[model samples]
Target chain A: MIRRDLVFEIGRTLIAIALALLLGFVIVLLVSEEPFNAFINFVAGPLTTTRRIGNWIEATIPLIFTGLAVCIAFQAGQFNIGAEGQLFFGAVTATIVALTFQLPMYLHVLVALLGAMVGGAIAGAIPGIMKARWGANELVSSLMLNYVFYRLGLYLINYHYRDSSAGAMVSYRLPETSWLQQFWPPTRVHWGLWVALAAILFSYLFLYRTRWGYALRMTGLNKDFAAYAGISVSAVIIYSQVISGAIAGLAGAADVLGLYRRFQWQQLPGYGFDGIIIAILARNHPLGVPIAALFLAYVRSGASIMSRMSDVSAEMVAIIQGIMILLVTAQAFLAKWRHRSVVREAKKHGLNA
Target chain B: MGSTLKGIFSVGFGYSMLRVTTPILFAALGAVVSEKAGAVNIGLEGLMLISGVTGVIVSAWTQSAWLGLLAGLVLAVLFALFMGYFHIKLGTDMVLAGIAMNVIASGGTVFALFVASGDRGISSSLASKVLPTVELPLINKIPVIGPILSGHNVLTYFALLAVVGVWYFLYRTPLGLRLRAVGESPDSADSVGISVSKMRFLALGISGFLAGFGGCHLSMGYVSWFSRDMTAGRGFIGLAASALGGVHPIGTAIASLFFGFADALSNYMQSLSIPSEFVQMIPYLATVAALGVFARRQMSRERKGKKQAGREVA
Candidate 1:
């Protein structure tokens, strides 16, 4: 039964991706002068160079973290979109630790990451507590907090952490001990890869093996049922959000320490929002998140290459993402086929029995 | 202190507040209409963006602001209807669909902008027409009140009028009753022969219509040309306003004004030597704080009501 369910889930996602890509190709044909070239580059350009492959891997790291974060929250049935704010807050906290702390290399990295998690957890707690305690709409409140933290981060960077000699409104460079060592020489990929893997593994175990995870899944499946079953639904809501925020915060820290020398992000890094698409594609499963993140990262990197090589812009991937999300989530999209397959399987099992 | 007082008490400040409030008011009213029909239009932000850009491009191409307004409204309604089909007919989750719509709008508008004009950031190349501002005949003669109340963009008046229009329609009209009935209980409404899907579609259509006005006001009256993400978070702010107002027209309007005041304060704070980033953060922070307070009050009130009901039953 589980195997059949997995097959259907995979089948639906694959079909949705294929259809979205096909539509994207049509859009390219309509808009681009060199449609064939653009589409080719968009599909195969990342494979052409080792450096480009590095770009894909580097991109995939943050997506995995955020995808896991979003998966956890969604599994709890909370639409806490404040991952964006949590990410920004986490990044800033990490930057602060990186700039100020005087520890050994690994210890410094550990402390910074912990700081980011705390920052993100606190950021996540606000909207979570509001919703769990007072029944506030988590979606709107999270979005509001995103803007607030983004601006607050900007203010902090501008006033306290500004590298006066640097060109833009950005923070000072991190200490040398704080930088995550690059694991791949040709690429900028760092220790964050292992960290992300650990996160995925940890998330999977936490969701599948833990009592709290059971309560979270129960709450997501049916809140009233969960409440009747003696689960503390409110506690589940708050902690799920907190855990999600901490993961997202970890992504922000990993991204900054692994990639850049200086805190150069002038705007909200949009990984949190992209995480939503990744989570949806992954069916909100931690085990599925890495695969989904890889797919998205590949497509995104390909689009960038396409933009560089052809007339089409990188924004085309957003259209594909949007269409894919809608199609995959649509309950009626391939309902007839799914129903037939289910019936056929049942009949076969009945005959065998 | 004197400069701050002057900035706050001036007629120009009030006028600017009303100007900034127009899009938010339209969005709030749109949110209210859709919420009444038991559908939350989280796509109001994207809808506004789509219409805002449409207004700019169409007006520039046709050299007529009225034509642009018409096209914008038409396109917004069409998209809303499409969302209706996806959500109602295809059984997609409303929030997910709305998020998808937002993503599409964010990307699609920029694509269209680049195709129509060479620039990717702003529509400065296009000779887009701005909507005319109207000066009230008698009000224009009045002292401080005149400048604050008169000589505003035409859409500003429409937004004010829409508040009352929405109130009357939602309360007094039979169709409004049906929409509310559909929202209140779709099963009961369906049992009574009222089409739940149709009412929802109508609710979304009205939402799109009102949001369209907000969009037009942005590109036309708020600024002379369309810029990328000109609507910013106004759509979300409007949604918050609708929620804060308890989904009532009058209450929503008042809530929108409160947000508008925060927005205006942010703008004024830029002149007060505070960091621009901190000042800009005011409205967004205000939104979160306000939602917290509002939700707390509502929950407490519900608790009280439940206690009273239990006592009566006993």
Candidate 2:
């Protein structure tokens, strides 16, 4: 029965996506010189080249972990939006570790990842603890904290790690040994992709196949009932957010190690917000996160190609995302169709007597 | 240290602080009204961005800053109505819907900018009209305070007026009480024969208009040209200020002014050896700290109230 409901949700989401794309096409027709070419590029340009495909996957790697992060928090009934800032905090510590120490290649990478995860978790725990102890609103607190974290990162890089000759407010180049190795030559797709997949799998197993997972879900579904059933609601809230932050931090560290040579971000990358949408579209199910992340990454990759190859701007994709999120989240939408289907099922089962 | 303090206390610093606070004050006051209507618009950054662009482009084309401001307000109100439709009528989650609108505004504004001016980075090609900076004729002759208060952008005085206006609108009007009731308890508001959705719609409309004014001040008053993400995080900062201010109009003005002071100080310290980045963090740090304290007080107050009630029952 749960499987059937999941299928229904996926079907509904596809319809929403189709409707959004149709709206996007209307805009393309109104604006672009060659609407057909632009639309084709928007849908099909990413997979046409090997490098582009790798870039698309490269873009998807960070989102998978953030999606899982959002999923964990949402499952525990916490709207901790700190994952966006947590990613940056992770990057900061990861960069520091990468540059400060000299070690074996494998050991350096491991230490950096561990440092990033711990940094993110500590930062992420601020809002969680605040909410648990004082009933502070996590949404506002987390949003405010992002700006502070961003400024801290900027200060650290600009002052302590300034490579004065670089002529920008970026850190010094990281050691080559700390880099995540690529599998295929010249294609930039590194081992970080497999690590992200493993994170997704671990998240799925932890959420569905563990006692703590049951407690988390129970807490989300009904806090009062869960508390009555002997669960420590406060502890669960803090614990889930910590785990969420750790996962997001891991993604940030891995992506930076795999893709870039130095820390150059001056602000939040906005992927954490994207993770919220990914989590929602995936129905807050860990197993569904990778597909959602990949789909979003594909849209982004295709949009970039569409903009370069045709007159249409990449924001066409944003229009699709906005319309899809609005329509898919509207609970009253498609209710009549759902009712009709349910009634048909009752008749088919002959339970009306 | 003394020189830094002197620099911060100078009349020029005070003038810049007022100039910087105007936009934040406008948005924070807007948030106060909307939050009192039971929905806090988290997409204020998007609203400000879209309208800031609209305000600039329309002012540029019409050669009238007023028209540009009007266009910006219209776009913002329409967007608010769109949000109300989905959030109120469709039963969508408010946060998700707000987030969607923000993303749309951010992306849509950029796209529109590209189509209108054929530039992704700036609107430097167009000659946009700026809002007039007013010099109080009689008051300009006064001492240091006069210099600090006079010759500000006209919208700064208007923002100050808006505080009184919003206070009147929220506390003195019959509609205000109903809106408050809705925010406090929608069920009770419904029991009293009030239309919750209608009240919310009206509140959001007013909020959008006020927020639009803030966006206009950014493009039309501050610079006369729209750059990409000119609002940056001002909208979010304004929201934070509103939260810290206890969602009251006067309190919101005070909090926004404080943020403006921090922002002005950060800019002032740019010539010094201190990193501007750390100084730039002051407003956000203040927000988190203020909110933390506010939450602690609320918790203690709640406990006290419960204890008093228990004693009465016994």
Candidate 3:
């Protein structure tokens, strides 16, 4: 019965996704003069070359980490909108440590990654502690921290770790010793892809297989009940937040060490917000996070390639993502549509299951 | 000592502070109202961003500042209504709806700019129409208070007036009482014949209106043009101000003013050979510190109340 129910849910989800894509195509058609070309580019643009596939993987790495971050927190019943901030904090820490220290290549990379994790954990813990101890709303706290982290990161890049030769808000270059090895020559893709996959696998095991994961899930589902059952709800919430922050921090580290030679301060990247959409689309499930992340990355990569090849702006990708999130989270509307469709099909068949 | 005092008095920090505070005060007033009605309006950031863009676009197109302000408000209210339909009617999660609205506004505005002007952001053809500053002629003759209050943007005065207006509406009116009751306990309010959804929707609409106006002030009153993400994190700062102020209109206004002072001081200090990046960090760091203080105080108060109750029981 459980397996049947799972299959039914997955089938319904796929149908909803297809309907959403059809609606999005209609929107694109209405908005664009070259509708046919735009639609074709959106569908087949990223699959045209190996470089584009590499770009898709590159985009998916950070998203997978950030999406998993959001998933862990959401599964523990904590809203962590500060993953962007955590990302910045982690990047800054990784860059500083990578620049300041001298070590062998493998050890240097490991230490920098660890530094990022620590930075993210600290940034993420603030909201968790605030929510758990003082009843401060995590949503507001996390959002506020994003600005704090942005400014702090910018300050570090401009004043403390600035490379004057660059003539922009960029930090000193990490020695090649600290950089991640490229998995494929001539492409920016690196070992970070494997790390992201490992993270997703561990997240799934931690959330579903372990005792601590079970406790966290229970707390997320019903905090009062979990408390009554002698679970430390507060502890679980805090732990999940810290872990989520660490993952986001790792993403920041990967972006800097794997792709860029220097640590440049991005004004804002929307990675954290993208993580929120991914978490929502995944329904906060650990196993669903990578799938959602990959889907988003594919759209982003395709949009970039399409923009280069056609007149359609890359900004349309954001519009499609917004629509997807809007449709996915409005589960009641999807449920109603599913119910109507199922009934209509049954009537046509002249049978009820 | 006399020279230092004179220098302090001569510096226009007080005026600059008011200018800085206006946007945040308006946005916080909007947030307080929406949150009180049990709606988490995270889309305030998006609303402000779109309004900021619309205000600049309309003003530049029409050569009238008032038209810009009107356009911003109308657009914000429309978005709010759309969000209300999704959250209240369609039973969508408020936060998710808010996130969707933000994503659309941010990316949509950029795409519209690209299509219309061939530029990625801000219009090139039209010169932005900035709102005229108002100088209180006779009132300026008065001593200390006049200088502080007069010769400001017209919207700044309105923002101050809104603090009192919001306070009265939230505390003194019967509608206010009903709205509060609904926010505190929706089921009880529903049982008592109050339309919880209606009240919540109204609150969100009002919030959108105020947030939109706040965005107008950013473009028309302060910067005189819209840049990409011009509202920056002011919307989030306003939300923090509301929380730190205990969700009271007057308290929120005061908190916003304090933040504004910090912001203005930071800007001023940046000209004095201070690192620009570090100076920019001041307001954000201050916000985190202030919020930390506010949270701790609330925690202590709750503990005190519990202790008193325990002693009474014993």
TM-score per candidate, in order? 0.96, 0.97, 0.92
List the lowest-lDDT window of 10 residues for candidate 3 chain B. Answer: B2-11
Separately for all candidates shown, the number of backbone clashes (residues 3 or more apart, or on different chains) is 0, 0, 0
| Model 2 residue B222 CA deviation in Å | 0.9
- lDDT tens readout by residue for model 2, A100-153: 999899999888888888878887888888888998898898888888888887
Computed on alpha carbons, the lDDT of every model, listed in order, comes to 0.90, 0.87, 0.82
Which candidate has the highest TM-score of all? 2
For model 3, residues B188-212, the per-residue Cα lDDT tens digits are 9999999998998889888999999
- Regions of model 1 farther than 4 Å from truth: A348-353, B301-314
Pairs clashing within candidate 2: none
Model no. 2, DockQ = 0.81
Residue-pair clashes, model 2: 0
Per-residue lDDT of B1-314 in model 1, one digit per residue for the tens? 68877998999999998988999999999999999999888889889989999999999999999999999999988888888889999998888888888888877788788778865758989999999999999988999999999999999999999999999999999999999999999999999999999999999999999999999999999999888778887888888888778899999999888878777877888777788787667667766887889889999999999999999999
Worst 10 residues of 1 chain B by lDDT: B278-287
For model 1, what is the error of residue B277's alpha carbon versus the real structure, in angstroms, after optimal superposition? 3.9
Error of 2 at B233 (Å): 0.9
Candidate 3: residue pairs that collide: none
Stronger candidate by lDDT (2 vs 3): 2
Task: Name the lDDT of candidate 1.
Answer: 0.90
User: Which numbered prediction scores highest in lDDT against the true structure?
Assistant: 1
Q: Proportion of native contacts found in each model?
A: 0.75, 0.78, 0.57
